[model samples]
Target: MKLIVNAIPFAGLETGITRYVRCLYQALGAELGVQVGYLGYHGLQPTMPQAADPDLWSRQTKRFWGLPQPLIAAINATQRLRLERLLRAGCRSVQPRIYHETDLIPPPRLPLPRVYTIHDLSLVNHRHLHPKERLWLFDLFFERRIRQVDHVITVSEFVRREIIRDLGLEPRRVTAIHEAPSARFFPRPAAEVGAMRRRMELPEDYILFVGTQEPRKNLPLLIRALALVKQPTALVLAGWSGWGDQAWRQLLEPLRLEQRVYTTGYVDEETLADLYSGARVTVYPSLYEGFGLPVLEAMACGSPVIAARAASLPEVAGDAAWLVDPQDPRDLAEALQGLLADPERRRDFAEAGKKRAARFSWQRCARETLRVFERVAARKQARRS
Candidate 1:
């Protein structure tokens, strides 16, 4: 069956969703009997396949700024019209049986069956974290798209439950597909890790946290926990700063841990892999997550992980790492201290994590997604018949 994968989100710089779409498409593209076409505003670009080393496709594209508010609104409206025209063109040329909306935005009402992936329902549940104007627009446009789609897919069971409870969707109408870490996240040798450290100028020993600096990530609490640890390990945060730097600084100030914390802002895949490899331990104490990709990535890199027990974290970690209550900074601090002091425990966790990481793969995710596509197409055919 001909399938059109929506790729609008790729127009900007890389994010978690970008990696998810790129990995799944490349994995599915390698298979036989499935013709795939990427329908994106950015046009075609190089993508990484499963056979190649994950780092091979890790380069970042040029970044672009959005137009002014009113102008951006008009431009997006025009793009939506153009996308509709493009969909019509595809329907006539390739006659696709299914249109998968990889990003949350639904495709312009189309004749073909529609499938959407709902990464998280944070916008609805944790609306306070987002800018009011953006949240308003998201609720207006994306919420409608979620309800109108033929089928929905979520990355975690946590998100699936939220969608059903908040949006009143039927459980069967949504499928939960867990995301896997890139193959490059596997354990790296000491020499390789050292080379990456030199290239990125990362400290020789540190604790790591990788993700956007949103309040939902619970960075302030992690900072507090870091201060409580008696170890001399530096805290290195890797990701672009969102919201503002004030909250991060304010939390670190009172604890006198300002000098111990470092922010790398953003780094490429090679550097990121090295950061994961060389770190003493990685901690992810987010308040909520649809899926915790970093927990698995750190596990794959042979680093002991300490993640929050709330939301989908335990489902992802699966006894491989120390699970802590994110709401309690004291508990998080105690877990961090315990893991830091015990080398045998760290090694034990690392070995178990590698084994657990082995269970997930992008190829498996793609195959499950393809089954959903087939089901969506069959339902459409039944209605037509």
Candidate 2:
């Protein structure tokens, strides 16, 4: 049976769900040997920003906020409605056996089988971190659309439980599938690593944190931890900026970490591999996570990782990373110091991490996800008979 997977995220940022959808779709068609049709944006026309658009929140927010905000929302909603109507017509014509929306945004309700991947309920569970208007948009457009789907796929068991709890769906209807780092993430050669270090002007010995700059990431606490570390290690922030008060930037001046903290903004995949490979310790102290992709990617590149033990991070990190309390900078500082001061432990972690990372693969994620689609398709077929 043929499947239609949304490829809308291919147009926007390379972080979070866009990366997840792009990697998952590539594997589904190429590795799983599934007959798939590409739908939504790219090669054709306009589509909503995929996964988490770094600019989505600001685009919706007006400087003053009372009248212009609502006016803009009304106009944008009208445009989106027209585009979605055309998209629904296109999907009806293709009439694929299954339609999977990898991006969290749900599609227009269809008669055919439908599957949606819900990365997390962070916005609902941790509402303070997100803007008010952003939450309203979800409730207005995509909240009910989630209930209209045939089944739901979650990235981690933690998220799967959240979906069943928050959405009040039958446990059987939701499934948790693990995500993996790409083949390009493996340890790079010395020559390649050296070239990337020089090109990016990155320090040979530094700590790394990869993710958007948002309140949920808890970057300010990380900066405090960096200041406390006895070792002279620079901290690198990779990925694009997202919504949230970046007053964290002001802390740099007072803390005297301005010279030591660096940002690569957004780097290409090959450069990402080099960045991960060169770090002395990769730190991810986010307050929450759907699935910690950076933890897996750093492990794949043989970088020793220190991640928050909360949520799905421990599940993804397993025994590979040094887990820390995301709230306490002192705890984080101690962990960083220990890892940096000890070379043998770092060596041991590097060896074990590569092996741990091998357990997850995009091909495997594709296979399991296809099984969900096949099960739904089979049920539909039996009913028609």
Candidate 3:
């Protein structure tokens, strides 16, 4: 079957969504009977030869927006017109059995079956989000997109439930496909781990937390917990700081734990894998998640995971990691301390986590996703017939 994938997000800096889309494309591309074409502006100028290059699609899309507004708007209009022209160009080129909008944005109302992947309801659920963001979510995007699409795919059951509850849609219309950590997240050798640590200037022994420093991550509670821990262990906060950088700084300032609290803005995948392998433990005490990718990644890397018992986390972590009440700093602290104090427990968790992580793979996700596509296409075809 012919497939048209909205791969616009892949052109931008790598994000969770971009990674998801790229991996899905690669996994599905090799299958026996499928043809996939990406539909979106390349981040380059219309006049440039690169604009027509499929490999440069992402870059061209970015550059399109970088142009002056009037020029950009005119170019965008032309692009849209061209897309319609191209879509109508031929039955062969246009008769895609499946149209997948990988990003949240729905494609123009199309004749073919359409599928949308809803990563999270964060814009609707996040209390700390800006008003404009809330407005865009509630008033502008998701509700209408959900109604228009033939099927919705979410990352986790938690998100699926949230979508059904919030949007009053039938649960059957949404499929929950659990995400997988990259293959690179698996255990690295000790010597390579040491080299990574030296490269990143990471402490010999540290407790790692990946994800943004947003209020939703409940980082302050983790910071408070760290204060209470008596061990010589340091806390490494990776990922870009989210909403609470000032508060995070204030919390860590007077504790004289600057040496103990390391904030690496963002590390590359190689260093990240090393950091994960070498960490005493990886803690993810978030208040919410659609699916906790970091927990899975840590587990896959053979890092003992300490995660919150809230939202989709417990479901993601299962019996592989330490589950704690994210709201209680004391409980988190005790859990961290307990894990650190016991070598046997860490080893058990580490070994179990690796095994658990092995069960999830992009191949499985791709197969499930293909099923959803087929289901949606069949439903659409039936309606037409």
**What is every candidate's alpha-carbon RMSD to the true fold?**
3.8, 3.5, 5.3
- By TM-score, the best candidate is 2
- Residues 116-184, candidate 2, lDDT per residue (tens digit)? 888888877988877665566666777678778889999999999898888888999999999999778
The lDDT values for all models are 0.79, 0.81, 0.76
* Overall local distance difference test of candidate 2: 0.81
Q: lDDT (0-100) at residue 257 of candidate 1?
A: 90
lDDT of 3 at 211: 79
Clash totals for all candidate models: 1, 0, 9
Residues 171-282, model 3: lDDT tens digits:
8898999989887788889999888778778789899999766667878788889999999799988875544456667877787777798888656667778889989999
By TM-score, the candidates rank as 2, 1, 3
Clashing pairs in 1: 239-265
If scored against the real structure, what TM-score would every candidate get?
0.90, 0.90, 0.85
Best by lDDT: 2
Candidate 1 ranges beyond 4 A from true positions:
42-82
In the range 184-284, model 1's lDDT, one tens digit per residue, is 78788899989977776777888999987878888988988888899978899987665544676787778899778888876666678888988889999
